[model samples]
Target: MGTTRTIKNKHAANGSGIKGSKASKNGPVNDGVIKAKKNAGTRAPIPGSGVKGRPNLADILKKRKKRVYSEKELGLPQLNMVTPVGVQKPRGKKKGKVFVDDRESMATILAIVQAEKDGQIESKMIKARQMEEIREARRAEADKKESERKAKLEETKDSLRKKRKRPRAGGKTQDDDVNGFEAVKALAAEGTKAAKPKKKRVSFAAD
Candidate 1:
């Protein structure tokens, strides 16, 4: 019994000591932790490191390059600078005036202002007599054409009614006058009498 107890203790000790022996020989160190600390320090200064203040409008405008244009530039009006697409500029007021661009619109407005300064009336009116004459002419033309068309339609209907009422060849007519059985019998008798020869009247002469 004492020898068996000693053998079981030796087996348990051998099993537990193997893992601790291997770990002592090749365990990992703290190099990975040190490297991670160094990386965190380098990344801390990267944020908010560039362009720290508000932008100056004057400085930006001064730094922008200026575009050169000659006196006779293509597709541009002589007086006004050309705006980019989708930018709408204000125009001046004038009667019967249209604008191709800002310059032309401004010119038209100035002309209207000058005219108003000279105390000219800007509104125009149509003559009442001319308007009445035009209205009367249109009414007369419409009435004449309408009457002519109605007459033509009525004539066409009348001709159609006449054609419908007319009798065809070898067909019965309303004027033929044979309507009932009595009229038919009378006609038959008259036809027979006319077809027969008439007898001459015999006269006895006294000597």
Candidate 2:
């Protein structure tokens, strides 16, 4: 009789001897493995890779239509892009008429005068106001007289212009009067004829 030998199968084990489920959650993962995953598709073509001759993940993904690429990643020259800034237009200044109220100033002046104990100052202010009023009245009267004078002068000029434009009377001589008297004498000698009726004029177009 022959001795029976046991054989181990290599395909029976799915992974490394370490079980992922049984592994400690707080344990540190391999830095090289983590780094390899992060830098899988982002590696530049300048330096040599530690691995054998193999295409990068980026190179494989670039063939796919859904992948977006940058200039640096595609090994193209970088473009200088300028961002547009919004500019506000300057507004025009309003040219408005500014009206000043003298009520406050007058009130302040009144208050100052009242605060002073001198009666002479008050009387002087009153006299100044009365003088101003009289001056204004005189100015108004002068303006009115000047306006009336201008109106009268204009009327006189208009009358002179109308006279210049008026037609002169006819210059009848003695010979013209003699001729007129002879014509009247001839008409008186002749018998009066029947007046002819005037013909009617057509006022509208025929339909």
**Over the stretch 53-154, how does candidate 2's per-residue lDDT look in tens digits?**
334532432332122222124543234455355442334845556554689987887787777846777889999999999999999999999999999999
User: Distance (Å) between predicted and true CA of 197, model 2?
Assistant: 46
lDDT of 1 by residue, 1-207 (tens): 444333433343333334333543322222222223223544522331223232342232112211112212333454347777656554554645654678878899889899886654333224566778899999999999999999999999887555433422222344244344443443455457754311210110000
True-vs-predicted CA distance for residue 170, candidate 1, Å = 8.1
| TM agreement with the true structure for every prediction | 0.23, 0.26
**Stretches of candidate 1 exceeding 4 Å from the true structure:** 1-126, 168-207
Evaluated at residue 103, the lDDT of candidate 1 is 88
Worst 10 residues of 2 by lDDT: 198-207
**All predictions: root-mean-square deviation over Cα?**
29.5, 26.6
Q: Can you list the residue pairs that collide in candidate 2?
A: none
List where candidate 2 sits over 4 angstroms from the true fold. Answer: 1-117, 168-207
Q: How much does candidate 2 score in TM-score?
A: 0.26
What number of backbone clashes does candidate 2 have, counting pairs of residues 3 or more apart or in separate chains? 0
